[model samples]
Target: MTGTRSVRPGIRFAAAGFILAVLLSAPRAEPPPLTLAILPLKLLDTSGEPIDQGPEHARRLAAMARGLAEDLDAGGDYRSLLVTAETLRARCPDERPDCLLAVAREAGASRVFVGVVHKSSTLILQLFARVADARTGRAVLTRDLNFRGDTDEAWRRAGVFLAGQIREAGP
Candidate 1:
């Protein structure tokens, strides 16, 4: 009986060692982070009238762009390409799809985020954002949000909500 008990312990020890060795010998791989380029949001007046959005609104738009890039980078799953609006414009002078694709290639980003903020009415603002494959220019995910007020805080809140939605959608 004692011999039988000793053999059982030895067998368990050998099995555990083998399992550990196999696990250690197996290759471990980590997926590469998604390289993302967040572009500035374009502004449009949906009412077909030229609305003068003052310099303050311009600053707010810039802030939202930076906020989007920061949020995506801090998520730890994406490598955000730090591309300024000027740099992007320099790379692609026109708003053509091909120009945008060329800029994405220049930035070395696998994915690109294009967005727009539209003023539909005096009290209504709409945001449209999309993540597209840089190589194919196909949209992977798109989100649109409407909110009241045109204040900086309102825009910031919208940005936060959009970022959260994008993170949950895994792009």
Candidate 2:
């Protein structure tokens, strides 16, 4: 039975010491998250119907966009810069790549996000989002999703789902 104690105390102590040293020497600080600028969502009517160009629709879309930015920020993967609809309109005015780049540069953001919500019918809506890199002027992430029901709650849920997907996909 005494022969079973082949492992020595000195070796165990050395192993523990090595592990402790490694743990103590490892870097504890993480790099800062990439700054992401969230632009206002574009509301479009794709059903060939005369769309209501009212302020209510614009406000709702802006609210949803803000919620998405907040969700992404809460995920702790990105530093979200949520721009107001009015500011975004005054700055970009369109969802062109060049405009997005300008906004990113002005905001000092590495990444910029733009989204469009197209209503095809009373109960069908399509949401499309794209994130572009300011340095490269290329899209880094893009997502498209459809939601049923013409209610604010449904739109909010879709926004939440999109944010979760973006976060899950990583920065």
Candidate 3:
């Protein structure tokens, strides 16, 4: 009986060892990427000059916003969803946190990104950006970037830099 009991325990120990080995060698499943809703970039002209709401300026803003989304999506950390201007104006005209969060929830996003370009002059622009939790409207990341020149290249560079910053900051 003692010999039988000893053999049973040895077999159980070997079985456990085999199970542990299999578990340790199995590949882990990575979590799905988080969905992010990126709102249209708002242009606020504080340059004290006449507001240039021309088509060219509007085009640049839209392009910059799209570039940011592409940069972020390229990282594979976030699935970027671009929000249209008409939807933004119609759903969240005031852009309050609650309103934005609602929009994000409606879009099936886990997070929301918002940005504003403050053009101080023909040569200077400031970018204010934030990422917030869609469910709680809590800010996860915020960054302010200052870049010179009003050209398309300058704006594109700024968007790239901001995207890198957000990725590094884990937003």
C-alpha TM-scores of all predictions: 0.79, 0.78, 0.92
Model 2 residue runs over 4 Å out of place are 1-27, 48-53, 88-90, 93-96
Which of the predicted structures, 1 or 2, would earn the higher TM-score when compared with the native? 1
Error of model 1, residue 68, in angstroms: 1.0
lDDT of 2 by residue, 37-114 (tens): 887788887666576655766776987878988898887888888766677578767656787677777888998888
For every model shown, the clashing-pair count is: 0, 0, 0
lDDT of 3: 0.89
Clashes of 3: 0
Between candidates 1 and 2, which one is better according to lDDT?
Answer: 1
lDDT of candidate 1 over 1-171, digit per residue (tens): 989998999999999999999999999886777888887778886655466665767888888888887887788778877567787677767778878876887789999889899887767999999989999999999998998888888899999888888888884
lDDT of 3 by residue, 1-171 (tens): 989998998999999999999999999887777889999888888778675556777898899889988998999888899999899789988878898889988999999999999988989999999999999988899999999998889999999999999889874
- Full ranking by lDDT: 3, 1, 2
For residue 118, model 2's alpha carbon misses the true position, in angstroms, by 0.6
Candidate 1 lDDT score relative to the true structure? 0.83
Candidate 3 residues lying further than 4 Å off, grouped into runs, are 49-53
